[model samples]
Structures are given as C-alpha cells and as structure tokens.
Target chain A: MITLKDVNKNYSSEVSIGPVDLEIPRGGITALVGPNGAGKSTLLTMMGRLLGIDQGAIEIAGMDITTTKSKDLAKIVSILKQENHFMTKLTVRQLVGFGRFPHSKGRLTAEDEEIISRYIDFLHLAELESRYLDELSGGQRQRAYVAMVLAQETEYVLLDEPLNNLDISHSVHMMQHLKDAAEQFNRTIIVVLHDINYAARYARYMCAMKNGKVIHMGRTEELMNNQILTDIFETPIEVISTPQGLLACYH
Target chain B: MNSTVALTPKPRTSRAPLYTAKLGLGCLLVLILLALSLLTGAFDIFSGEEGREMFAISRVPRTIALVLAGAAMSMSGLVMQLITQNRFVEPSTTGTTEWAGLGLLTVLFFYPSASILFKMSAAVAFAFIGAMIFFLFLRRISLKSSLIVPIVGIMLGAVVSSVSTFFALQTDMLQSLSVWFAGSFTSIYQGQYEILWIVLGVVIAVFILADRLTLAGLGEEFSTNVGVNYRRMVLIATALIAIATGVVTVVVGSLPFLGLIVPNIVSMFRGDDLRSNLPWVCLGGIAVVTLCDILARIIIAPFEMPVSVILGVLGATVFVGLVVKGGANAR
Candidate 1:
C-alpha cells in the first residue's frame, strides 16, 4: 500500500502541488489520469522518492519514504520515469542487470541472472537482449526500460507515462503485460496514463487529478462516467458503452 | 511477433582471457614507451656511475610521474564526462584545472614557502568547489545540445584563469605562473614526485565505484530510484576529479587536453561501461602521455619542450573533430 498525506511541493511562487491526502491500496492497477500540467508526474515521482516532499508524509508498505533509507526503499518500490538517457553504451541485458543493483551491487549471482532472463522473456525482449539500447527503436527501448523496472521485482511499481512513444498495438500489449504482472506477481502497479480509454480498459482503480488535487478516486467503473471525467479534464467528454468496453471520447 | 521470439540462451563465457589479452598488449605498449623515455634523456644509462644515478634520480621518477599523471588525468576526464553527462567535459574544460591554478597562485602569493601538500590541498578544495559550481550551473540551465556544455566550461575556465592571471601580475609572479602552467615532467624527482602516488589511491577508489558512476550517468532520477545515492556519488566523483587534477597540476602543471582526448579515444574503442573501460582508459592515458613525453624530449634535443604544447596541438584538433561530429549528430 502507498499513502500520501497532505503532501506538498512548491516549485515557485505561482506553482505548487498538494495538500493531497490519498491512499493507493495494494494489488492491481491504479491509473492516475489527467490533463497535462496536472501534477501527475510530480506526484508519482514524489511517491517514488525521486523527488522530495516539502510537507507531509508518503509511506510505502508502512515505511515512511522520507525517513527510510533509499537502499531499503528500493527493494519495496521501483519507478520508471518518462525520459531516460544514457551516456554509456549498454545492451538491453546489461541494463536489466542494473535492476539487481540494490541486491547484488553489480555482482550478479546465477539467481539474479535467471531473474533477469525471465523478465526479458516476460517483456518479449529476449531477441533484443544482446542489442545495445541505442540500436533499438523507441517502442523497443520503452519495453526494455519496462523490463528493467520489472526485473527490480519490487512490490510497488510506479511508472510515469509508460506508453509515451508506443504505437497503438504496443500500448495495448504493454498494458496487458502490466496487468498480467500485477496479477501473477501480486504486485501493485500505479501508472500515469494519458489515454483515458486505456485507463478505462485496464485499470482496476482510477485517481483523477486537476490543478494538483485528486478530484476523483474510486473504482474504474465509478470514475468512468461522463460528468466526472468532463469535470476533471475541463473538457466535454462523452462516455459511450461499446461491445468492447466503456470508452471516453473527447473529440 | 516473430521478432520478439526468444533465442536459445547463450552460455555465459568468461571475458577474462580477452581482458587479459588487452591488458597484456596495453602493458607491453606502456612498457615499451617507458623504456624509450628512460633511455632518451641526456645521460646514458649504459655508461658509468653518474649515468646510473641520473637514471635513478631523474629518468625513473620522470617516467613514473608521466604514467601516474597520465592515468589519473584521463580517468578524471572520464569521471567528469560521466557526472556531467556530456562527452566533451574534462578537468581543463570544466574550470577545474584553472581553479587549481588560482589556488596555487593564492598560496604562492600569501606564503611563498608553502609545502607541496598545502598547495595540493588548497588546489583540491578549490577544484572541488569549482566543479560543484559547474554542476549547479548545469542544473539551472537546460541545454539542448551537448556541445554547449564544454563551451560553457571553457568559458568558465577562462574566467577563473583570468583571475589567476590578475593576481599573478599584481604579485609579480607572472613569469613563475606561466612556467608552472606549462606542464612538463622535466622537474620531477623522487623527492618532489611522491605526492603523485595519491592518484593511484584515487584510481583504486574509482574502480570500486565504477558501477555506481555508470548508473549515475543515467541521470539523477533513475540513479536515485535504483537506490544509488546520487548526491553522494556526485560528491565522490567530484572529490576524485579534484584530487586527480590538483595533484597533477601541482606536480607537472596542467596537461590541457590529456584528460579530454585520452578518455574520448578510449571510449571510441572500449565503450563506456566504467568498470570494463577503466583499465583501458588508464593504459591508454599512460601510453599517450609517455609517447608525448618522448616527443617532448627529442623534439628539441638536449632542451625539452613542455608536454602541454604537444598535447595542446593534438587536443585542439581532436576537440574540433568531436564538436563537428557532435553537431552532425545533433542535426
């Protein structure tokens, strides 16, 4: 379980996020969905302990993020941000090996290698494991990075915009993979998604935010109504029931 | 879907033999250069007692200084590039060497009789502070092109060097300052050159922290998320760079592009996994510097030219090539 209580971050005189109080339960997919500049990434990063909280507390499985040693926190939670750049040349397999750093500290054991291979296979990146990251396409690279985060084997996986550069089929594939990981591994996954339809399709829970505040938090079905999403996005959003599922169309 | 299919898992093959081969070749090259450097000086080692004394007191120490300073500076350059996430950044380019110079000048002005240890510590402190300032500036200004980083660093170095020049002129130490700035191993001896051994310790520490440094190069958020203390790693990298630069600057003066060019050249061949790339970087550094030192000795026989002059010509050419390559990549 992840908890944020009255958490705040002040960027400048005119920009600040939170006084947010929220709890994300353990297990399944919880999607944070909102428009741009809605502090989705900021909140996710703060929970990941990539960014420090100015006020209040965030706890991952009852361990206070602010007080917990980073090495300890790393075992319980892992985060993948949107933009990742590397100065060194690293193969996909080597990059995934870094996910075991908290445990192995660069000396990967046979067990660690087995786990790495499993995650690579899970992400369907076994063919590309020997390929350098710079040689891969954007979607392939994104999958490699996701594989790295999964190889961390953390209970709480927080991903900020995992679908940023992916195509339609890849996006769906990624969501399905995340869903399977969440269920099979019994891990809690919090993902910040841009496509409301994707969120509606795969997420078990939804947290809608606007102007740095969580305006709506409930079951995915409850948060799928037209009025709620329209208010949260400040746009005319129409929710129509299709044979596939509930889909929200803004255009 | 076919593309995503798993291949048969390849057996893990030990790279120890390949690494050993590379190490063997590198050591052979450095050893050859070391032999040439030891033999090329004014006194003949194949002769009598005076020649043996000269070999012991002068040539051997100078050769050792060449190896130590070379390896240390190049590793320093590699560390700086990793920390800054820029390819062109090095101790000289990033104002670190200039800051060390300023520290040396200040010490010379205030206490003319200061020990080498005091001078080196002062320089290290200033270099660390200077590198910290550069990082702070980097955080504030979001640069689009990687080329701008080194340009800004060079300008920052110019600013610091100007300050040193100003103080040197006022204190009437301009001539002495210029001589010190032109790096050479001519003055190195057993007594005066022992301080450079600190670089070996720094190199060992860097080897231990190699993996962390590579992770830190991935960016702050990713590094911290992976449980590497990003700030602590940066601080450690900064200290290593400062000590390497400070000790080298004090012992042999500033080797302008030795740091910049050596690492770039090594990475072009070995890639940038810090752990694997480290030994190659050190060996390449030692080889390049020793070769340059040999040239410096023979270029003006019986009278030596400063090693920095040769390095400057070679470094500037390679630096320009890198900028062009980087610009082409940006496009």
Candidate 2:
C-alpha cells in the first residue's frame, strides 16, 4: 500500500499542487489519467520519491520514503520517469541488467541474469536484446525502458507515460504487458497516462486529476460514466459500450 | 511465448571476441610505446656503461611517469565525464587543471619554501573544490544545450586562471609558472618523480568502484531509484579526479587534452561501459602520452618542446572533430 498524507508541492506562488491525501491499495493497475498540465507526472514523481514533497510524507508498504534508506526502499518500489537521457551508450540487455541493481548491487548472479532475460522476453525485446538503445526506434526504445522497470522486480512500480512515443499497436502491447505483470507478479503498478481509452481498457482503478488535483477516484467500472468523463476532460466525451469494452470517445 | 534462457546468459552483446582482441592490440601497442620511450632518450642505454645509469635515473622514471600520469589524467577525464554526464567535460575543459594551477600558485606565493608534496596537496584540494563548484553549477542550471556545460566550465576556469595570472605577474613568477606548468616530462628523474605513484591508488579505487560509478553515471534519479546515493558517488568521483589532476599538475604541469580524448576515443570504439572501458582508457592514455612524449623529445632533436604543445595541437584537432562530427557514435 502507498499512502500520501497532505502532500503539497509548490512550483511557484502562482502554481501549487495539493494538500492532497490519497491511499493507493496494493496489487493492481491504477491509472493516473488527466488532461495536460494536470500535475499527474508531478504527483507520480512525488510518490516515487523522485520529487520531494513540500509538506507531506509518502509511505510505501509501511516504509517511510523520507526516512527509509534508498537502498532498502529500492527493493520494495521502483520508478521510471518520463524522460531518461544519459551519456552512456548501453545495450538493451545492459540497461535492463541495471534494473536488478537493488537486488544484485551491480554484481549479477545467475539468478539476476535470468530475471533480466525474463523481463526482456516478456516485453518481446528478445530480438533486440543485444542492440544499443540508440539503435532502436522510439517505440522499441520505449518497450526497452518498460522492460527495465519490470526487471526491477519491485512490488510497487511507478511509471510516468510508459507509452509516450509508442504507436497504437505497441501501446496496446505495452498496456497488456503491464496488466500481465501486475496480475502475475501481484505487483502494484501506478501509471500516469494521457490517453483516456487506454486507461478505460486496462486500468483496474481510475484516479482522474484536473488542474493539479485528483478530482475523482474509484473502481474502473464506477468511473466509466459519460458525465464524469466529460467533466474531468472538459470535452464532450461519450462513453460508448462497444464489443471491445467501454471507450470514452471525444472525436 | 516463454522460452527458457540460460541462467548465466551469454556474454553481453558482441563484446566477447572483439573486446579481447581490442584489449590485446592495445596492450601490444602500449608495449611498443614503452620500448620506444625506454630507447629514445638523449643517451642510448645500449651504447655505454654510464648509459645504464642514465636510463635508470631518467629513462625508466620518465616512462613510469608517463604511464602513471597518462592513465591517471585520462581516467580523471572519464570520471569527470561520468559525473557531469557530458562527454566534453574533463579536467582541462572544466578548468580543473586551471584550478589546480591556481592552488599551486597560491601555495608558492604564501610559503615560497613549501615542499613539493605540500604543493600537490594544495592543488588537489583546490581541484576537488573546483570540481564540486562545477557540479553545483550543473545542478543549478537545467542544461538545455549540452555545449553549455563545457562553456560554463571554461568560463569558470578562465576566472580562476586570470587570478593565477595576476598573482604570477605580481610576484614575478609568471615565467616560472608557465615553465613548470607546461606538460613536459623533461625533469622526471628518480628522486622527484616517485610522487606520481600516489595516483595508482586512485586508479585502483576506480576499478573497484566501477559498477557503482557507472550506475551513478546514469544521473541522480536513476541511481537513487536503484538505491545508490547519487550525491555521495559524485563526491567520491570528484575527490578521485581532483587528486589525479592535482598530482599531475604538480608533477607534469598539465596534459591539456589527454583526459578528454582518451575516454572519447575509447567510448567511440568500445561503447560506454566504464568497467569494460577502464583498461582501454588506461592503455589509450599510456599510448597517447608515451607517443606524444616521444614526439616531444624527437621533434626538436637535441632541443625538446613541451608535450603540452604537441598535445594541444593534436588534441585540438580531435576535440574539434569530436564536437563537429560528434553525433556519429556519441548519443
């Protein structure tokens, strides 16, 4: 379980994010969906302990993020941010191998190597495993990063826009993989998403944010309403039940 | 589709055979350079009885100095590059050498009778402070342009350098300062040259800490997420780099482009895994410095020029090449 108590972040005098209090239960896919500039990434970053909270504390599985040693907290939770750029030119396998640092501490045991390869194959990245990250396309690169976080093998995984440069098919594949990861590993996955329909499809719980605050939070079925969708997005969204499932259609 | 992969997994990527061959070639080249350094001095060791003494006193020490200082400075560049997260950053570019020079000058000014070890310490301590300042600047600025990082460092170095120049001019030590600071191995005899061995500890420490350093290289958030303390790693790296730079500056003055080019060249060929890149960077450093030092000795025949002159010219060409055509292998 992840809990945030009176969380606040002041970007400036003109902009600030919550005084937000939220309790995210363990073991399912929870999608943080919001319009642009909704502070969704900010909130996720705070929960991941990437960004410090101004006036609140975040606890992951009873371990206080501020006080718990980073090395200890890493085994319990992992985070993947939106933009990750570094000067090191690494292969796909090498990058994924880094995900096991919390467990292996840079010395990869045989088990660590197996886990790394498992995540690689899980993301359908087996073919590109030996390739350098710069050699892959954006969609392929995105999958590799997702593979890295999954390889971390933490109970709680936080991702900010895992589907950013992905095409429609790749996006579908990614969401399916995340859902599979959650169910199989019994992991708690929190993702910040821009696409509402993707959230509608795979999100077990929907946490909708608007203007720097979480406006609605409930089960996926309960939040899948036309009025609620339209209000949160400030667009004319109609929830249509196709054979595919519920989709929020704005266009 | 669940396929059973091997537990050990094959060696990463296409590195196994090619990496060994490359390191083997680098080792062979280092050996040849070492022989050349041993043979190409003013007195030929094979010719006379005093020649063996000259070789022992001067030639052998010069070669050791070249290898140690070479490996140390180049590795220092690697560490700086990793810490700053920019390929262009190194002791010379980041003004670390300049800061060390300032430290050297400040010591000489105050305690004109200071020992050589004292001088090295002051320079190293200043180098550490300078690197931390550069680190702080990087932390404060967003770095929209990658080029701006080196520019900020160069500008900061210029400020420190001018202060050194002012002090040098006032004390009438400017001429002596430039002479002592030139990247030359001319005065490296047995007694005074053993101080270069201190950096061997730094080189070994980098090897032991290679994995943690590489993790730390991926930036703060990534490392922190993986449970490594990013700030502490940077501090450790800076200290190592400062010691290398300070000691080298005190002993050999400054090798302007040794740090930047060696690591960039290695990464260009071998990719950027520092643990793997370590041996190559060290070998490349040894080869480049030995080759340049030989060239420095031979360029003027009976008279010798500073190695920094040759390094400056050659290093500038490669540095510019790195900048203009940088997008090739560099990401």
- Which of the numbered candidates is closest to the native, going by highest DockQ? 1
The global C-alpha lDDT for each of the candidates, from Candidate 1 onward, is 0.89, 0.88
True A-B contacts kept by model 2: 0.58
lDDT tens readout by residue for model 2, B1-331: 3455444445543222325876888799899999999999667687688888899999999999999999999999998888787889999988899999999999999998999999999999999999889988998999777788989999999999899899999999999789877979998999998989999999999988887898889988899888999889988999999999999999999999899999999888777877778998999999999999999999888778999999999899998898888656444
- List the candidate 1 regions with Cα displacement exceeding 4 Å: B3-9, B12-18
Residue A229 displacement in candidate 1 (angstroms): 2.0
TM-score per candidate, in order? 0.96, 0.94
Strongest candidate by lDDT = 1
DockQ of each candidate, alpha-carbon based: 0.57, 0.49
Model 1 Cα lDDT, one tens digit per residue, A1-251: 88899999997887789989999999999999998989999999999999889999999999999999999999999999999886677788888888888888887788898888888888888878777888899998999998989989999999999999899999999999999999998999999999999999999999999989898888999999999999988899999999989999999
Q: What lDDT does candidate 2 reach at residue A14?
A: 72
